[model samples]
Target: MSSCHKCWHCITKRTRKDATRIVDVKQTKELSSPGAVEVDSPIGLLASTTAAFLGRARRGPLNTPVFIENFSEFRDHFGGCWSGSMLADAVQQFFSHGGTNLYVVRIANNARGARIDLPGPNGPLVLEAAEPSSTEHVRAAVDYDGIEDEKGQYFNLTLQRLAPDSSIVLDQEIYRRLSCQSDNVLFVGSELARSQLAHVCNTVPAHRPDSTGAGYINQTEMGTDGSALSDYDLIGSPELGTGMFSLNKIEEFDLLYIAPSMTSCVPGPAAVLAAEIYCRRRGTMLILDPPETWMSTSDALEGFEEAGYAHPDVLSYFPRAMSSHSATREESIAIGGAIAGLLCKLDRQSGPWEDLDQQGFELSHDLLPALDIPASEAHRLVKGGLNVIVGQRPGHAMVCGSVTLAHGSQSGDQFTSLTTRRLCLSIKNAVDSVTRRTVFKLNTAAVKEHIVADVRKYMDELVNAGALKNDRFSVDCDTNQGEKRINCTRDITISLTFDPACSDETIKLNICQAKSDSEVASQYA
Candidate 1:
């Protein structure tokens, strides 16, 4: 980086007085986010959980995404989305493949859990489901015929909170002959607080709830599932700092994934484009799931044409993944989460530069490529800017290609390779971190010399670390000699250029026969 520093110099006036004049002194310095893999994904959580953990991410100027460091926290907060949603499955698979530092952005609209009204002397007491979901139906019954307490006004209160499907009772509580009075030996407030599925409203009845003829009182006005979500719901507003964009508040993340619900409904094109733009701005890679129409190689090409995401910041995986669920076998789910897990695995086990298409790369036990892709078909998909998995069995499911879904004239082959693109991002981030610290320093010779030295030192380390090819890289931060604006006080310019280490994706070999043994040996070698 280079900046011009202005200084005042005293000049003696010929006639009477001394005057101070300003002069521009140009200073030049040459310089370079370094960290492990961090992945972030947007998931829709049950409405009940959002209120329980509202602002749990500690919202402020930097509205950091909620950091889920372990599996238990994920299960406790985001495990069941209504009837055990797809988010639970995706999170389980992500953790199973050694993913760490996972951040989840839970999406929820205005929806409350099931509510029930109990008959009371003063008024009907209202109770709401502990977790938010329309399917969380709760029931209660009063037993006045049970053993009477000392007051003879007490009754047994039995409450049952059913699952989303109402197939099983998630929680049950029976307060034996408990008085409903606010200040009694065993008040309903203290007794009902132990229920896991529902909680009492603010108001408490003065007397015990009347018996409902020994039958359970069902909830009226069941909660609605709220509005149908769209891309806007997921992207949200930057000003409001919600949804996927909220991930920007965090310090750094390596991979970002936004998977569609298991219903096979892909996120709208606008949301996907917004996510792509965010990844580009943050120096992160996005793993995109193929459209529902991408069942075959031809379909994948057509899908790319329709979507038209000609950006190297994204990697598209094709032919949905086949994994068996407890309820079903050979279920086709979105592969974006699994791909992200693999990327994290690669970054940890092997360096990021290592090709992901090599043999021996394994997938989770339950996952497999949905389609039995032949070699020719796989090649066709790879050329069309889509990554493909070639194998069919566990520990044999190797990623056959690692290409980005980029096309058109402006895009070049250099960015088409995922490794090369990631390397370029890594270099830019490293250099920016160092140079931004020297923004307003004095433009003196000593400063310039130190800046250049610092930059060269970092670049040299990168070269030694195999991130850069050699010392052919150069850092130029001096003022432009040809420009008259070199004297401009406010102008600062920086130019950084380097050749990132690129891996060969293909090799060619030729075989020939010779008459003599020596010649044949030489040719073979």
Candidate 2:
């Protein structure tokens, strides 16, 4: 009988090429059956068959149905101990080739120390474990989630989804196993997760602390020491006392009207706040709406007062109970839409100011006459018009001057054609008088009626002549004064851009308004 040697040297020697020449002799005392003697065959055949079976048996038991189909062995040329990189590469290749999951077996001599290196698709990884005593090592290694060694050291590996924080929540057992050497563990997952983790580790904190007086300290105030409010001296310095004073001022206007609907409130409040801020910064006076009138009015007022501006008195609220009854959601939406349209038109008008000079037109000379204003006053009127137009485009209309040009200059000739391109109208009621009355009292309804009639007549003519695709011009009016007094005052104003050369005579006629003494006449040839 031959004894089995588990020693690496003994096993290698037995399997070496030199061992093939060794002879095996077997003799039988008697044959149990005449046919059995022939079936047993020669000693050489028996030795060859037994050696092959032993070679396969050394790998492990074949309890599991799944088995490795293709296996290759490579000798390490470096003679150094095996590493995880080698094992990781094999695993990566196997997975890449459509192998869903797999197990690896590493065989190394005791002196060399058993270690397997695999290079995976993601990156290189290593697996280290002790040599197996029997074929059971195959099953033990496959089922083992962590290492169990005599030194009581253990390691658990797991796969999981990456968290938003870039950390993975490991199973309790695995976490316990890895807790001892957390630094050695590596996480493998999606690129997004990796990126998120990188962001968290790289984020920087804001240096300056938040201010109580204001939400945040001004960046300009931050000094080299990274502290705000650090520059002033505490001693009896006038500058120090001045720094503590409020930096804003309040201005009073004729009336303060707050829009009733939140829809109307949107840009209105923002505009008011902006106006307040501007006034505060410039020491201008502004009459603010009542706190209870709009939801955000109180906060806005408080903010202004805190910023050092004087508190304003609220005069009235808009969409008065009676007037509101006549207003519909559609009307509000239409008003909003019209406001947006006006804003767009104004934007288009003002944006081209920069390009006006390139067109051989000075804003003070050629462009002003087109709108019908004198050269000297054209710049001022254009600027005022821009401000009012921007405000009115969104229903926050204000009385504004229009651009005019010098009457006699041939320079005005170049602008006549362009000036005729707009429908010019003007209203000159006293600002204080117009704002004192109710919406119904303000003769705006009648003015709006006349404006609408003219718009419809012009649009109809344009539509008939095929100059305009649709009759879309519309108008609405609201005022703070009574009807009789409103009609008496010339406070409301409106203008439109039109094509003077359009085939529609009615539309063309409405392009320019008759000149008045107070009126800045627009010249359109």
Candidate 3:
């Protein structure tokens, strides 16, 4: 949003000045250390969805999270995307692979919105699209309808956000009893301020806009989709809250992903590192895609080491899938969405704590691995922190490895397994959610007990669901937490130890996520 940033956008394609080292090694190691945990309370405040996606789209507002319950909703919202658009593919694959709840945040790469002009008595009334995109088509209509103003002082206006195919109205706004006079309460600008489709721009005409024929079918000036996404566009500035940072506005999500593959063109190294850090901070997992450079197994191993991407919170795989692109043509595509969907299905059928290896996780669509990775090669990739998709026949492809990007002395043994890491995240989210309910309550003796009992109850609930091993956990709290209690700080630490049903090791946690007063704890048990 600064002048310098504005110039960065002027470039047709952004290239990383320092690609060899995208992140500070020392800082990354310190952050990834097992001892470091994102303990901020506000980050744990929302009810989380199964997953979320941020990427380039042919439509929708930039950096705004749109919750999608199904694929139909996605199609209806982001209508008429370019053929083979990464976002559209990912969403379609997600539903095909059994994912139910999702949040999509569309990102703009210096795009512009379409504008329209309505004929008015003195001049033209201008209106602009609320969200920029070539596919952001809107139609407006002005009619006298029920107006009694014979002098044509007032007119009814109808606005519709139409799909690119112009077959459906995604959204519609209707305004009645309106006048073009600025002094009138029904002025176009005043009423348009509340419109979702379009808003009035420039100046208001002295009289109402001339009526369009029939209904909301008046066309607007075509918009420009702009250029493809760049690494700068995806990483976005945290201060400006663009790109992944805009996710902070959302209540909650478990996993984050980019629809486009993690190639040098889109996500690249810089974006991947930024996403990993953000995911760790949010207690979520970043479903990293195979870099486009990984055309083969050997290249993937060498590339993995060179990239220095050993974060335990990042999950990645290699050897893209050969998906049917057209009736006679096939194209290679990243399988990140399929993996995320597999995780979602597993999370529901069993739980996030369920061991993925034993789950027999398979790709849903008729997808075949671009490379036929042998068992030995697959094992090597797994050891190197890269998963693989194995298929002997069409529609029989299955993921081979269920590991995080924590390889060789990362010392994050606790998170090496995807199941264990997810178990910890699930436990953390559960504890935070349960404790947050006590935020507004008085920090009294009974309230303190309520906090402890509530958390204990949740742990018990997890045990009942077979996600955790049966164990009695203790909640550590200050004897007094009301008006005046030890430094008068409304903070209490809770410690619990448990074993995850899907994990082989016993886990211990000291959850101190604070707001008002509460002691929350979780462990593998």
Query: Best candidate per lDDT, number?
Result: 3
TM-score to true structure, per model: 0.61, 0.15, 0.78
Give the Cα-based TM-score of candidate 3 against the true structure. Answer: 0.78
Question: lDDT tens digits, residues 372-425, model 3?
Answer: 888888989988888778875666778767788877535467777877788778
Error of 1 at 54 (Å): 16
Model 1 lDDT tens row, 240-273: 8777756645545667776455446677899889
User: TM-score: which is higher, 1 or 3?
Assistant: 3
Model 2 reaches what TM-score against the true structure? 0.15
Question: What is the Cα root-mean-square deviation between model 1 and the actual structure?
Answer: 20.9
Better of 2 and 3 by lDDT: 3
Candidate 2 per-residue lDDT over residues 1-525, each given as its tens digit: 122222111111111011122221111133243323112111110010000000011221111111121223211101111221122233222222223212222211111112222222233233222212121110001112334545433322222211113333211111223212223332211111222111111111221111122121111111111111111210112232221111111111111111112222222344445543333322222222223222232343343344332222111111111112333322221021121122223323432111122221111110011011233443332322111111212222221222212122332322222222222111111111122122112244654554445445544554454444345543333322323222232333333334333223323221122212333221122
| Colliding residue pairs in candidate 3 | 498-524, 498-525, 499-524, 499-525, 500-524
